[model samples]
Target: MPSSLMLSFLFFLLSLSACSLKTQTTEPEKISHINKENYMIPGINHGLIQSPINILSNEKHETKNHQITLHFQDEIKAVENLGHTVQLDFSKGSSISSDGINYEFKQMHFHTPSEHLIDGMTFPMEMHIVNYAPPATKNGIPHYLVIAVLFKMGNENEFISEFLTLIPKQSNNTVKLEKGRVKLHDLFHDDLSNEMKNYYHYRGSLTTPPYTETVNWFVLKHIIEASPEQIRAINDIEGDNARHIQTIYGRHID
Candidate 1:
């Protein structure tokens, strides 16, 4: 039998070895470096502002409903430095999945001076209504859905007048605005044509700093009409609020 000192020495060695192994195992994996040119976009430059793009088509498109409704309450006011983001309690503005899947509307926000360019044209503003699905599906899958709407110049944008009135005129990034219920019908126009129903959809990351790639983008084919005054009103309220567009990264535009 080994002497007591030798036995103690061996035990110490084993314990040291075990500690080394544990340290190696606990080290976190290195984060992969991402190239900004390959993933980021530098949005509109600080140049003299140009007049609104007058591009339009006589083409009409059929419209469909996603069954979303939102009610603004006293508690849904704006927050500071965060722009205007309203959180709907429960599934207030969410879409119901008949496929036995449940989803909830987390919140809604906007991007001024446009984010997504359609056919090489940028709109005055864009809004994103974010939704999160329930737990994993039967196939062990979970997903998020984001509906994006582009606002342009036109007189038919009266639907947004009430909402716009809540925007604060100060240069502060965030502010508290009155809460009101905004129904799905309030945002969507029913006079769209069949041709306008087609949209450009693809996997994309959020258009903000620390841009996350967890959004399922559904961009409408037809741009919603907003008066030039409406566009200026929002811009005046939230100057340079939009983030730069990110690279498509060979990502398929479905």
Candidate 2:
């Protein structure tokens, strides 16, 4: 009877050992099966992180490879109405060209009720001067350089008076550039105050859809003054044409 008991105990021990080995071998295969799904591992870089961006200061100023010449055209040849935006096409304008960056003015557009906010304050309106350059000069960068002009409430800006008249009440409408030939040199007067100082520089995406993040923003410290009447005129065209501010993404302020 004792011998029979011993044999039975041995058989039970062998069965238990075999089951443990089987479990160990199959566990790795189960993990391998999950790995084949090509799932992203946890802790990957998701868009959840909102980085804090730094505002640029004068100390961080660097030499701009490209310079722009502002021109005033008395008579516009064509006015294209892009819905929510308007363009004043010019035939000719002078631009400061460089080997690294060469920019030519394509057109000028406007956004009412302002698009950018300084310290959470909105301006009356903003003007965008669009320029284009070849990829070679831009180091294969795919972006259109836009110069933004912010307007605040003040005395009327003489150079901008005629340009504001052509803004259509409706979106996607085109108006002819009436009047005579507008000279570019006359638009930008010799105002020492107009120089861009105390600019906040940062890398940002375009506010428009497709949201290309190739733009380097240089928001001037001083606000340009415009007459209250001009602000009222812009409000007539667009009650709310500006976009919400985008994320700075923890970028360092210069």
Candidate maximizing TM-score: 2
Name the regions of candidate 1 deviating beyond 4 angstroms.
1-81, 84-93, 96-102, 134-143, 168-181, 191-197
C-alpha lDDT of residue 6 in model 2 = 95
Give the C-alpha lDDT of model 1. 0.51
TM-score of each: 0.55, 0.60
Position 212, candidate 1: lDDT:
48
Provide the lowest-lDDT 10-residue window in model 1. 46-55
Query: Pairing residues by index, what is the TM-score of model 2?
Result: 0.60
What RMSD, rounded to one decimal, does every model reach? Answer: 15.2, 14.8
Per-residue alpha-carbon lDDT of model 2 for 1-254, expressed as tens digits?
A: 59999999999999999999976655322432342224423753212111112233433545533333434332346666676666677655534232345566667666776776665677778776655665665456454555566788888877667667766667777777655634333444643224434455554545565444445455655566778887776666655677766454334334
**Tens-place lDDT digits, model 1, residues 1-254:** 56998999999999999998875543111111232234333573221111112222221222334333333221333433343332222234435331244546565666677777665677778866566675465764344566677887777475566456544444445454544543334556452223224555454555653354444566766577888887776666556666555443233344
lDDT of each: 0.51, 0.56
